[model samples]
Target: MGIARQLVHRLEQWFELMGAEYAYMATDRSNEASLRLFTGRCGYSKFRTPSLLVHPVHSHRLRAPRRATVVRLGARDAERLYRSRLAHVEFFPADIGAVLGNALSRGTFLATVGGYEWGGVDRFLACPPASWAVASAWDCGGVFRLQVRGASRLRRAAAAATRALDRAAKWLRVPSVPDFFRPFAGWFVYGLAGSGGRDAAMAAEAVFASIVNMARGRAAAVAVEVAAMDPLRGRIPHWRRLSCTEDLWCMKRLGAGGGGHADGWDWARSAPGQSIFVDPREV
Candidate 1:
């Protein structure tokens, strides 16, 4: 077999040894050779389309028509913000409420406007000295969520939020996670706009700007994972030709499959998986 084929075989074997039931590589839609290499040669199937968004810290070429005003969100304001988001999106209030409440408990930062809350961005910046000792073993990348009531308004707020995150990263001196994990990181922004509220061109611009801004804040890379399709406007240009990994699959190992019946693996009862990607720079 050729070198490329050998590499693919090795990768499959390695993942299997590590107990991975499903694994697939992601590549740019424009890269036909890569697509062929993974899907044509390897026994992988097309799964989903995910758009990756990127924004360089030094580059701010995308311009917004309106300037967004950002300020720290207070405790009461955070609750209000959560309520507003629940009203706009089709999310379980109980689940979103618990998330926002926990963020508040963990000392999350919030952004708001004119006493009315549109969205919020939270982070965990302070870590113990010991936490830094083994930072290389953990993925210290930050995670944040942005929600807006309307598409036009969301665009404005997302832009301002993106800038704010970048500013925070600069002050903290940590390279954004999205930037560091590029290509492998996968970045994109998913927005839900009301029908007839905005044109496709304007909405696409806003989503692009939001993702780029978030990326600029020092992330190694950024990718937007949209769980469902939007009915209003079709897929945007920047996200027209995106792809995604296959759905993670798991199975149970019956008796004697690997060990005795008492030692058989029960995939259905397996604990949820967790992964950490610590930034080397932190070490």
Candidate 2:
């Protein structure tokens, strides 16, 4: 076997030995070699196409919808809410509580408008707003930094000049390029979901914007990955220039099984779920 296939087999064997019933992976849709390695040689199948929505953090703070009330949720409360609300989502991790409570997690938050009142966590959980959204923040800054590669000298010089100008004149409000040449920190918004429809989408956008605001000064960008058909995706505020819609996730059952429903349901054969929980640890 080739080196890549051998590496994949080794990882699969290790997972299976640890009692894993399934294997999952994601790759850029443009990577033909990776697609073949995972799907053709490794027996994985095409599963979900989630878009990586990204928004650059402006020098100024971003405002959430004026009418929306954003609230940070405790880890326990966030975990409970996600369990109940996202149980139907494909590839939902079982250790979501650990993820939410991780040190790198900034916090989980929710947004609601239309006369929604804060009545304690229990009450809020019992009767969530008819139009609401929920999301959790992961400080990817703690994990790693990203830097753009293969830029021409002229483009690099222009980016540096823009940054310099923005720093020199605070009031210019120049839409300068982000610090892509240098390593930059960023935040990831995972577990993104909305109740449904237009109102819920608005609430979701507000929550996402709130998270971006929270990351101001500390992160270069804010991002979230959501299934293509997710109801709130179209409304979530993200810069088209910084977003990508071609991230593909693939999955397969391990061992002698042929993608069987080991857990009473096979996510591989299931239709596109409403959303996906992007595990921060994997990112």
Candidate 3:
């Protein structure tokens, strides 16, 4: 039975009843049938294409440079930072505080390199470091399970062997592969932002490494989504083998609207921005 079309219609009706102005859905670019269903039949237009960057969690801890200070932000402080620094970024959520405060949320963190004191948000923002980066960690494992499909026997055996070796030798710090064959949880990085410069890139790399290190044991891996043109893309550390270069997001106006825009500004048609806020709930 062709239920997808009917489901889309019902969802749109529900959206309208909920006073939603728009609705969007994401799918892999290679999903031809999904693309056709949403774009041709459901009237959803092509929208944002962001890359999903993933890094495997290692058994060892990765530390930021001695000069850099990593701060774990409280929900209120994290909300303040996002509202002030990322308000204009695409897909910035209004209930960020709620998201940050969710049980599944690991924490929000900021990495900075300088001789500054943590007086509070005001002091940090007032005298921001030359290279600073912020990110939030969401424990996706608690929400749902993910399994990797179609892996060959050899790959699985190799992964198992590597994991065994790492377990046998704890001092080696071997990069063990996750058991993708089984349902496992992974950490999702959201609200990634940073300043501009080589130092900023280093700081971002440190932040990503730190997240991966922190996620070990609890999560099999850590992943983050960013726009192609996002400045932080080149800075964040990820494995080319594990990351997706492009993930498609399609959007449609639920109510009578002018090209999915209120004042002649379509989000789908807008140019790619430097930064993006990847909401874990949506991911």
Sort order, lDDT high to low = 2, 3, 1
lDDT of 2 by residue, 35-80 (tens): 9889999889898899999988766556577878888989998888
TM-score winner between 1 and 3, please give it: 3
- The residue-level lDDT of candidate 3 at 24 comes to 88
**Per-model TM against the reference:** 0.34, 0.90, 0.90
Give per-residue CA lDDT, model 1, range 1-283, as digits (tens). Answer: 7788789878777777887655545455667776666667664555444333233332333342232222334445545444443344422233433443442122222221123233333321121111100000111243433322344655566655655575565554333222221222223332222222233323334444444454443433334333224332233323222234332322223222333246654433344321111112211
Maximum-lDDT candidate: 2
lDDT of each: 0.36, 0.85, 0.83
Off by over 4 Å in 3: 1-3, 63-67, 149-153, 257-262
Q: What is candidate 2's TM-score against the reference? A: 0.90
